[model samples]
Target: MYDVGTRKQALALVSQGLSLNSVSRQTGVSRAAIRSWRTRLEPLSPRSEPCPRCSETPRDPDDPPAYAYLLGLYLGDGCISPAPRGVYFLRVACSDAWPGLIDACAEAMRSARPDNKVFRVPRQGCQNVTCHSKHWPCLFPQHGPGKKHEREIALEPWQQRIVEAHPWDFVKGLIHSDGCRITNWTTRIIGGERKRYEYPRYFFTNKSDDIRALFTDTLDRLGVEWTHCTRAGKPYNISVARRASVALMDAHVGPKY
Candidate 1:
């Protein structure tokens, strides 16, 4: 960030008919900065935007819990796509089965990028919840080319910190997307009498090994036990069926309505 005095000096040098390269050499400012100063410098550049992730001494997002939740939603089922301008769109498909989840996703998008507008585009079986922001990549480093399952998805240190602080919100966000709670019942003989026992459990299914690891890691932090279930020759399911673990999940991330 150059000061006014520096800008004035650079402009003065330019007024003297000095080349941008020469001025940059003398003023120690980038050639781009000196070139932009030729027209006007008061407004600075869009780079001055207060993006927490891009700021010097970068910090967490303004709403850490929302960010953590949004990250979960992104890693679980969200996507970032390029737009017409330099901005990119962050979208998550919310099933029509859960209108409340759609609303919650919109709220999280709003909280994550308060200045950006959130939209819900209807589809055959779901609502595409999305928002446009140039900083989406900065916020979600896990975004990349091709399918997420085919590539690695790892969080930055800062994101891990946020998830650690708001494990429940993160877990709930993932559950809202790729996880669910269901009750499985079976008949058993207790004291020679037929009885029905219902097991309430959570199932988080994702094709990405890294993402599943992230979910299970958070569950571990929350003292919730999870087991891997391989089916169809693939290990893509995480189950929380233990009584205590299911209770913990119920207390934090219950059935999605």
Candidate 2:
């Protein structure tokens, strides 16, 4: 089955007055699949009533830590889509390997907007936790077209305050979504004998400079030292290899459960 992203792209092409054959060719999804998605998502009438939950003003999350962390996750790998009839959708793609992080993300959405329904849609190698809320765009103004690296990402005044108050939580979310802890090995020549030693380090990889800056800035506030690197020949990376820095991160973020 095609993932939500692919299905959404097909639907978008259809909405833009593209033919089923054209959308199928562009998205590589079969024409039948495109038709199925169109039929499933299209409203019977343009005047269909909006979801009742859309009318309720979703309050800002009461827990700053949870909200701030979720914000970091959104910046890293989440997306916001405006649907028909003023319905809004928020989806965060998370690795299936990290079930705990998936649960945490879903819980955060529930806490942030209890009136709305949240569900996980399965995909190959990952799962997308999605929710519908008209207030999502207000919560995440960073939503836009194209890759994040090609666009600007900045926080609003209130979002800045939340991150500043709970920087570690923000870092935790960023690292959990886009960073990893790994072992690095090095060889040393001691008295003409080669010795190998292994050290643990944390690495965060993203294509966006602003997102990398935000991660490093949070690390700086926590007195954690890090360095810049590149991965996969293109994506920028921030790495924390120092023992003290790793310890500090451990205290705050730890490993994904």
Candidate 3:
């Protein structure tokens, strides 16, 4: 990133038709690092503000259980869905709606009873904010409001088998999750001066309350264990949480479920 004088320059070089790997090699940054830098800088470009729909101020670490609250609201009605490629934000609504929607989802999550909560962040474009997050209408044009074409759904044979094997259970047990791109910084103190270097971070959601228990129960019932990795590459490791699913069911599922 330091080597590029302007984003246009970087983008041009990237678009001039070099593979990301090739671009990274020429630029001396890892492809992942370049991608992270792109996520940070793209939104703040001279022409655009960071997407308000996807952007939110940092939460206070000392604050009370705001984490679950934020997660719940964000997951609204708590269902998970899949993308043909992976999760990514859609450009439907004005970009300004990001933070309020983020907050709204949090409020919804905070007040909902434990059994009703769901989390469904997928492994691909989930990091794309506007694309994958339900706050925007479906990106599949045919499936958008008033259109008849439905979004293509995915459930690998294994996932389908797992879902099928758990038929007797009741809580709609499945993997629940979502994630955000965060940049981590390392600060070094030298002679009372601090300098920070950034590393990309992934903020992933786990099922709130009984959702986790239900997921574990369901998976146990099915005799299957699930593993998940964010498209952004973060991993959830707990035995119970690991086997869970994302709760983004369908477009209508948010307001009602």
Candidate 4:
């Protein structure tokens, strides 16, 4: 890895109106690396806009409902990390199978980071919705140095309050990311005739016990009945098979598009 001084020198030369090729040749750094540094090292304040969590008078997100949803998405399949300079990137991955889910993720991120630009990066079968800003950590206090499952994930008091108020939004976000609605079928004989029946249920699977608890706690508050099940011989699934609870989910979360 190049030293910080090397990166700074290269950035300085590029700032002086030097073409990337000229900067690369003079500094012996690859043009691609120079371009990457140029984008991250630009003279921009992480707080070009007022941050709700970090402004002079700290407050909750302007759009608490959207933030609640985004929080669930983060816990399910999103991450925040330091970018070059003082910037940080927040990214949420959505499967291509559900293009509408991708759009929803983008909308939530836009709502959360109204001042920053949102980007979509395509992977083999998924799209990553991301934004760059310095205040991601301020909003997501649960962020840390390891896999979410490996760490103890707990919401700040403020965040818990938001979730309490917008539990459906939070549940939808998590379901869209790491949960699904599926049909389970069985055959039974009735009156000497065999009939096939199907049961609609919702399943939320995550390795992190804390995340699972967060989900169940919200469900409990909402009076939605749920139970643990072993799927594929793995005991990481939370199943909601009660007809009333399924109706609640259908009315709110629905099948992910």
Evaluate all candidate structures by whole-model CA lDDT and list the values in order.
0.85, 0.81, 0.34, 0.88
Q: Which regions of candidate 2 are displaced past 4 Å? A: 1-60, 232-235
Report clash pairs, candidate 1.
none
List, residue by residue over 1-257, the lDDT tens digit for candidate 1.
Answer: 89989987886565444578988999899999877766552432334346788778888899998888888889888999874446678989899999888988999989888876677777789888878778999999888899999998898999999999999999999999998899999999999999999889899999999999999999888889889999798989999999999988888778877
- In model 3, where is the ten-residue run with the lowest total lDDT? 248-257
Q: Point to the candidate with the largest lDDT.
A: 4
Pairs in clash, predicted candidate 2:
none
Clashes of each: 0, 0, 35, 0
The order by descending TM-score is: 4, 1, 2, 3
Clashing pairs in 4: none
> Candidate 2 on 24-71: residue-level lDDT in tens?
889899998877765574543334223322447634457788889889
By lDDT, the candidates rank as 4, 1, 2, 3
Better of 1 and 3 by lDDT: 1
Better of 3 and 4 by lDDT: 4
Q: Estimate the TM-score of every prediction.
A: 0.80, 0.76, 0.20, 0.85
